[model samples]
Target: MDVGVILLTLVCYALACLLWWQLHTPVFLLCLLSGHVGALASPLWVLLYGVTYRADLGVWFDVLGQPVYSSVVIASAWFYPLPALIILYLHRVRWLGARYTIALLTFLVMAIYHFIIETIGLGLNIWSYDAAPLLPFGLSHGLISTALAATISMVLLYTVLVVQRFSLISMVLSLVPATLVFSLMIQGVLGAPFWVSLRFAESQSWVLIIGMLSTLGLLGWAVHIIAWGMDHMNWELV
Candidate 1:
């Protein structure tokens, strides 16, 4: 990692801690930790994508001959969780009247936020995708893929953390749904069904639709469990 990136990450971490203090929600740390784990776990999916599609997600900077970028990593792990945490805090305090409403709105807001950041990042050559397909008016597959993946991961992380008490087990379990949804979204964007996408082959539309619905159903059930846990368990700062 570059020295500047490391310094900036520390500064961001400090600000995050300060935000946690001001918000009086120690769950901020847990959410941040979950985001970090999610980001770290991304390399596995990145490798799979690279092998399956020959695409590179991003390359802001490299460290130790690896494609990891510290600035992006820090943003994804730290800053990305702030909006979700704020929304969750509001919901927890009853300022937000409905959980599902807050959840849906949060997801939309985060998706647009990430999409804008990705557009700027692409313009600045912070990253590039290989032979990316263009959408209307020339938006590339890279921008859409990154934005959607990041947004889904953020919202899922927030939902899981809010619904379940903070614990190692809960955090790890959260990754299950998050990763599953992420993989499904990416495969959809890549124009393939789940199994065929993994094999880097073409897929039928019906198969794609079925896979997406099934995965969404599974993810919805996981979220329901989280919601039930939230209502039944008296969550506390650990």
Candidate 2:
């Protein structure tokens, strides 16, 4: 990557900060970041799927349908989601009903935006398509993945923010850890693994599987808890 491209991206993000002000604070920015990180993680699936295939997957490139640029962006997208999830999880614990619903809804909303971008990627050949049915929300490879991510982010964030009554400063501070954790996740997803656990997890293979399942469960529980709170408490959406 050239310094110019990096500089340009930084500017884009700075614009994104401005855009956030025009939008809904860090929440909107988190949605965009999640989408970008997810795209970057495409290489992870490629490596696993490529090796299992009998033929060569070919060099990762932009034109050849495996562009390194897009891959990095996707992995970058993955970084924002965890904090969103954490935020949502907290909301569910404190008060479920509508606040949790808002959190849940925002997560899904973010995923939808992410899916639109991913759909564009598939068309651009940023990654190889291996759909058995090729339907959205089926194999979870295309736009469906986008929807899922957005939904999860919103729901989770809603719960966390409402439950914790987080101040802007704390929410912003949380992003630091989120970025660190996800940067590592993205690295692992891209075969780099800045941390040993990611590399070791790759070796075990089941580690990633367990991690993903646990994430799913935690997310689901978050939604469920919010439901419980909603029923028990008379929380209404503002």
Candidate 3:
């Protein structure tokens, strides 16, 4: 019963609903959809790191009597929607473009945001990232991993919205399992190295370090892909 997190989640959901009602736009709906997807998909990352790299949630409620934390699950509802908010804000300001500037800026913002939240979670005993290993500045592997997930997902979501132009069909499609599928795919792909190293390597000391570097390299590649995709996309907003 992490009261603070629960309250924050409620506020986020309420604000999103209010905005959607007032604006009647697809972006807010996208945020809400992303939140739902995050709630479902967020725990998978924890499950990965928990088994391999040693992350843990505090004594919160579990899913299906499993070790999953309810706090972790609910916190994701707020976390995942943030990228949609970023995309919407960037699009509104005409700052959304196919360039390194937009992609890098988005990545930095997401990374900082993820790092801060993870640090706070660690401080609050909501989770632990110290068991296996840590990055510099006492950062957790989850920081880069999640930021990459969000940034890549944001870019892909933008591409989808641009292609579909928020048509009624597109709206319906984007607001459901499609978002979940992509979210999972992005996370799974980006997180594979770390999981593999920790899962299979008898001595994960060097392998984990290599895995971390590989994950960073993949993140850079993903960012580059975002820029390339943005360049190819036509600016057709319906």
**Candidate 2 segments exceeding 4 Å error:** 1-12, 15-71, 74-98, 131-140, 155-173, 179-238
**Per-residue lDDT value at 175 in model 2:** 45
Cα RMSD of all models vs. native, in order, equals 6.8, 9.8, 4.0
Name the 10 consecutive residues with the lowest summed lDDT in model 2. Answer: 189-198
Listed in order, each prediction's TM-score against the native is 0.56, 0.42, 0.76
Write the residue-wise lDDT of candidate 3 on 96-117 in tens digits.
7545476567666666776776
RMSD of 2: 9.8
Q: Could you tell me the lDDT of residue 203 within candidate 1?
A: 37
Better of 1 and 2 by TM-score: 1
Q: Which candidate model has the greater TM-score, 1 or 3?
A: 3
Candidate topping TM-score: 3
Give the clash count for model 1: 0
Which residue pairs of candidate 3 clash? Answer: none
Cα lDDT of model 2 by residue, 1-238, tens digit: 2344356556546655774565345643554454454444444444433311213323345422544453355334433454464344344344433444554464455655667656665665544446222222234445334433444444434333443345667654554344434433333432222122223443565554454444445445645664556444444332
Q: Where does model 1 exceed 4 Å of error? A: 1-12, 19-24, 50-66, 92-94, 132-139, 142-147, 154-238
